[model samples]
Target: MHAIVLYTSKYGSTKDYAGWIAEEIGCEVRETKKTCIEDLAPYDTIILGGGLYAEVIAGASLLVKNAAALKGKKVAIFSTGITPLSYREYYDTLVLEKNFKDGIPEGFKVFNFMGKMILDELSLPHRTAIKALKKLMSGKKNPTEMEKLLIELCDADGDFTDKDAIKPLLDYIRN
Candidate 1:
């Protein structure tokens, strides 16, 4: 089957996953900025990847806005974030709610994977935002467990990309 993976990355984490998925499926992978929705119509499978920024999936609205044109195509979305995979409730509910407001299209699947954030490599704006977020969470008198976790995650640094993490996606694509 013909497949194409499109992705956007702020810190390279999302692009890393997109490259891995393309290697597994042996299909073409392009940055979302370089590929147009109409250009993807010929592919049978479409895999999109983006990094999570403040719980927002980057460049995802492209797919959501063009949902009608992409109907019936095999669609998969993957997100790279620092949040631990154990936060399924937050990712599955809050994150999903924020991105798929109208509803996730049928036949479309979503995946979440651990990503990296090198404090030193972050752009000034990203660093400032992270610090600001931490400060805000810390100011809460009795922060929720999730808030506490976010504060901790703000300090995390390093890359956590693993080939094993791509197995589930590969299986889904192959099936």
Candidate 2:
């Protein structure tokens, strides 16, 4: 099947994942800025990835807004983030709700993968936001589970990407 991997990465994790997926699946990889919905017409399978900023998947509006045009095409969307997978509520519930307000499309599937968060590499605004978030959460004497997780995540500072994490996505595409 014809396929293409398109991605929008704030740092480099999402681009790295897109590269790996393209390498394994033998498909072209392009940045979303250089691609448009019309550019995707030739591919039967489209894999779009973006790094998570707040709860939104960066550049995902392209797919969400153009869902009608992608009908009948196999679509897989992935988000790279530092949040641990054990937080099912965060990924499955909060993330899904915020990203897909109209509900996931019929042929679309979503995946989440661990990404790097080196404090030194973060943008100035991102670093400031993290510091603010950490301070806010830490101030809560009776912080909720999510708030606690947020505080913990603020200090996370390393690459957490794993090649094995793409296996499930590859399986989906192959099938």
Candidate 3:
């Protein structure tokens, strides 16, 4: 299959996954910022990988915004975040709803993977945002389960990127 993997990564987690995916699939890998929708027209399969920040998938707008341009192609998106996988409902529901406001297009699929969030490596703004988020969540006298998860995730600091996580994405494109 003529496929290309596009990724936008801030801390290399998404880039790592994209690199692994490209290596396994034997396709070209390019950063989303360096590539455009027109550049992707030559490929039969298109894969997008992005880091998740406050439910928004970084650089995914290229795919969502240009959905019409990529019509009839095999499309798949993978999102990376520090949020734990036990919150499947949150990922499948809230995340999906926010990301795919219109709807998941035909011939498209979405995947989620654990991402790294090293406290020391975060930018000044990201570190501030995480602290603010944690404070806000901590203020709730009895936070909901989701809020609790958010609070816990804000404190997460480590590398959770795994090469095996790309298998589902690989199988989708090959099949």
Task: State the lDDT of candidate 2 residue by residue for 1-175, as single tens digits.
Answer: 9999999998899999999999999999999989989999999999999988888998888998899999999999999999998888999999999999999998899999999999998899999999999999999999998999999999999999998999999999999
What would the TM-scores of all predictions be? 0.96, 0.97, 0.97
Off by over 4 Å in 3: none
Query: What is each predicted model's overall lDDT from 0 to 1?
Result: 0.88, 0.93, 0.92
Q: lDDT tens string, model 3, 27-136?
A: 99999999978898899899999999889989888999888888899999999998887788988999898899998888789999999999999999999999999999
RMSD (Cα, Å) for all candidates, in order, is: 1.0, 0.8, 0.8
Task: Return the TM-score for candidate 3, rounded to 2 decimals.
Answer: 0.97
* Model 1 Cα lDDT, one tens digit per residue, 52-111: 987888888788778889988888888889888888888999899999998898778888
Question: Could you tell me the lDDT of residue 8 within candidate 1?
Answer: 93
Report the candidate with higher TM-score, 1 versus 2.
2
